[model samples]
Target chain A: MLELDRVGVALGPKAIFNDLSLTIGPGESVCLVGPSGAGKTTLLRLAAGLLAPTSGEVTNGFRETSVVFQEPRLLPWRRVTDNIALGLKARGIGRRHRRARARELAAAVGLAESLDCFPHQLSGGMCQRVALARALAVGAELLLLDEPFSALDVGLRSDAQQLMQQLVQERALAMMLVTHDLIEALRLGHRVLVLAGSPAALVYELPVTTPFNERTPAWLHEAAARLLRQPLVQASFQPLVDREAA
Target chain B: MAAWVRRLLRGIGSLTGVLLLVTLWEWGSIRYGSFMLPGPRDTLTAMGRLAEQQALLAAMWATSWRAITGFALAALAGMALGLLAGLSRTLGRVLEPVATVLLGIPPIAWIVLAILWFGSGSLASIYTVAATTLPIAFAGAQMGARTLDARLAELATAYRLPLAQRLWDLYLPHVVSYVFPALITALAVAWKVTVMAELLATDTGIGAGLALARVNLDTAAAMAWVVLVVVLLLVAEHGVLRPLQRRMEPWRTGH
Candidate 1:
């Protein structure tokens, strides 16, 4: 389980988050959905332990954590397999065993043929798949994803979402994904939280009851539209535009 | 096969141009009928004579060592300083203008100062070479570091990559793009400046050998020394530097 207790983050003179709290138990998946610049990424970074909160504590039971950033952060100089092997290498795994694990993960992500290809040689979708494979290869109990599929085409995004669902189910791992795309949130998240305003705070939390196999695009879009139509959602987003204009 | 053919054609064209220039030199020498205008054949014969005396080998070694040592020092110092400057805005502001001034000063203008500092020996030659080479290396390293992708760095930090891995895998690779051209330029300048410094300050090396030939009014020997330096430059370019560059940056080949 991973827990954020009354977390507050200050960036320079501005508060990015204040009095935020959340918890993810084993095998649970959560998504933070918000308009652009609602500090979803900042929240994700804190949860991943890549950054520390200004106040409050983040407690984790997991020994390992992995993050899939908005950009596919695969090393440009490394081949797909090597990038996937990075986490294992960090943990002092033997080279041969690490390569074997990378191969397995690459195959799982449908990037078997691209094992030797460098990041620049792959398409945007392929790079994201590589990133996903890298995260999964780490064998982390908690995965933090920040708009992992934002660059992919709709079809590729859906495929990646399905892959994420399968990985979560198979490993029984907890994940927190941050995205502006409501449809993606509805499809992949077991629970979705809406974040808003300056010194951003969670406005709503919605539980997703739809099964992975049973969910349809039309139904997902309808749920997303309903979520967006909430008055709090509009009110939450308004402050961002006003802040920027000022 | 087509690529090979194209490369072969380019080589042939270069050879043809050199041959034409040699032919012209021979014609001009025949018309002039003087040692001052020695033809390609005469220069080649003079080179053979110098080789027989073994002075050419000693001179080549002396000049080569000076250039190599000086350039190596410049590379080390420049990269260290450049990384500092690249990572810190204040350091860059403090040093860049000084580097620019040093770079602007001609190599010849510094020869007298180098002799005064190092006292008329191989050290003088090495100092001059390093002085000329440092700015190129410094600028290249700075540019390389500045242009490295911030996203990649953020990724590295997020992954908690260890210092060694970050340097070897990310920083080194990113710096190579600028470093290669800078290194090539530095090497060429180092050799030229070292030889020139030796000519004025010392009694060894190819440059001093040329000075000795001039004092004796042996134009052929002087020309022979010049030929030796040119040959060394070509060998270093092809046998050492080109191969190193290719090995360091294989991805650049397709681009």
Candidate 2:
């Protein structure tokens, strides 16, 4: 479990967020959906204990947490298996045992064949899968993903999302993901939260408790229509869609 | 097979350049007269003469050993200080000025102080070389460390990578990239300073041999020593350093 209680963060002269708070309970999948510069990534960093808030407190109770960054962030020097093994290696697992475990994780992520490949040699989607595999290899109770699927092709993104859904549910992993894509948030998250405005605060929260892996197109459209009906969520969409339509 | 051909052609191209230089030297020798500027042939003959006496090999060994010893020490000190400075803002602020001051001081100035302290042995040469080269490695390390990906460090911290694991997996690879070019530069400076120091202070290395040749007015022998020094530098950079770099960063080579 992770909690950011009434957090305030100001970088230089600009304030990113004031009096913002969030909590991700055990086995909870919370997706943060926001405008382009809504400090979603910064919020994730705050929860990961990477950045201390200008005011207020963050309490994280998870024994282990792993993050999949926007970029794959694999070591260029390491092979796919080695990169996956990194968290285990850091946890003092032996080389032979970690390698075996890494291969297993790679298989779970559908990257077993790429175990010997370098990051540079892999396709973008494959690289993202490796990043996912790496996070899973940490055996962390909490997984934070920052647009990890944003760069992939739509079909690949769906596949990765399915893998993520399966694994998270199977392991009962708590997760916080940041994304701008409404459909993705709706597709994968148990609950979706939105932020808007310059010094943003949480504006809307939607709970979509349908079994995500089994959700239909009709369910998605109905949820989208409902999300669009939220005054604050609709307001956040106005500036971008109105300008694009004009 | 294609790779081999490309490699062979590259080798041939390099050899051709060397041959061209040798031919130009021969022409210059004929024009200037052998006494003033020896031909490559005359330099080779003098090398053989010195080699027969075993003086050339001994002097070469002496100079190379001193340079290498100093280079190794400077690398250790410089990299350690560099990492310290990069990792700590206060240390960076303190050391930046110190490294700048050291860099500003000439190696020749250090040679005088080194001789005064160590009294004209390899110690003076070795110390002068290390003192002159430290700032280069230090600067490289600092820049490398400063620019390292913050995300990588964050990942390491989140994973609770032990200090040693962070070092081996993350910090060292990044630091080494910066350290390498500096090491190459430091090596060149080490050789130059060691010889200059030996010319003034010691009597056992190639620098002393060159000094003796200057006194006897044997231009070819002096030229031969110059050739040997250049050869040693080439061998160190190409033979040892490059291969070591390739071994350390095999991932960088193909893709």
Candidate 3:
């Protein structure tokens, strides 16, 4: 489990997170959605232990943790197989063993044919799959992803989302995924949380009772439309919608 | 054209350029007599005499050893110090100016200082070469280390990379991109500085052979020594460094 209790984060004089408390238990997938610049990445960073909260306690009880960033962060010099094996190598797994595991993960993520290619040679979605495979290679009980599929086209995005849902279910892995896309959040997460307002804190929390495999496009759209119609969700995303309009 | 055919065309172009340079050289030699500049044939004959005496091989070996050894020392020390400086802001501030000062100091000045310290031998030439080339390697490594991607560092933390793995997998790969180019430049500087130092302070290298040739007023022999130095440099660059660079940076080549 990863728990953040009344965590407050201040970057210089600007407060990003204030009195934010959350918990992600084993086998639970939590999705956070918010407008751009609403401290979504900061919150993920805090959960990943890459940032320290200015106040309150942040505790991660998971034995291992892995993160997938907004952009794929594979080492450019390493081949796809080696890149996917990075986290395994970090855990001191032997070369042959880690590579074998990496191959399996790559195949699972639909990158079996591109193992020998470098990151640059792969497309954006393929590179993101490699990054996903790398995160899985460590065998982390908790996976924290920050907009992992935001860069892909709609088709690839849905494909990646489906892949993620399947993996999370099969492994019984705990996940905290952050994104601005409402449908994406609803489609994959067991519980969806909304973060908004100045010095961001969770404004709404909704349990998504629909099964991962059962959440179809129409249901997702109808669900998202209902959530968007809520006064709090409207108020939270107003600035973002206004900015896009402008 | 096919890749190999294009490569062959490029090779032929290089040969043509070399032939053009030789033609100009022959023209100059004919105008100024063999006593002055010396024709390529005269230099080749002089080289043959030196080879028969085994002086050419011994001189080439000595010069190559000093240059290679000095470059190795500089690469080790400079990269170590550069990595240290890059990792710490205070160390970077303290050492960056020192690197700049070292770079500012001329190779000739270093040669003179080295001769006074090492007293006219291979050590003096080697020291001079190391001093002249150290700053180049240092700057490359420091830039590389300083410009490390913060995202990669975060990824390292998230993945819980061990220190050894961090250095080998994370840091070294990033640093090598910057360091390799610097090392190539430093290697070229190493050879030049070694020759310059040998000309003044040594008695057994190609530069020293040039000094001997000058004393005997043997212009052909001097030209022959110069040619030998150029060939050695070319061999070192193309045969060793380029191949090593290609191996280390196969990703960059996209092959």
Per-prediction DockQ: 0.42, 0.60, 0.81
Model 3, position A50, has a per-residue lDDT of 91
Local accuracy of candidate 1 as per-residue lDDT tens digits, B12-47: 999999899878878988898647877777788888
Residue A136 lDDT (model 2): 87
**Model 3 DockQ, alpha carbons vs. true complex:** 0.81
How do these models rank on lDDT, best leading?
Answer: 3, 2, 1
User: lDDT of each model, Cα atoms only?
Assistant: 0.86, 0.89, 0.93
Interface RMS deviation of candidate 3: 0.8
Best-matching candidate per TM-score: 3
Highest DockQ, which number? Answer: 3
User: Candidate 3's error at B9, in angstroms?
Assistant: 3.1
Q: Which rank order by DockQ, best down to worst?
A: 3, 2, 1
Alpha-carbon runs more than 4 Å astray in model 3: A242-246, B1-3
Kindly give the stretch of ten consecutive residues in candidate 1 chain A with the minimal lDDT sum. Answer: A234-243
Cα lDDT tens digits, model 2, B131-244, are 989999999999989988887888787677899988788888888888998999999889888888889998999999989999999999999999999999999999999999
What ranges in model 1 sit over 4 Å off? A237-246, B1-3, B6-37, B145-149, B216-222
True contacts kept of 1: 0.37
Model 2: how far residue B7 lies from native, Å: 1.2
lDDT at position B143, candidate 1: 85
TM-scores of chain B, in order: 0.93, 0.96, 0.97
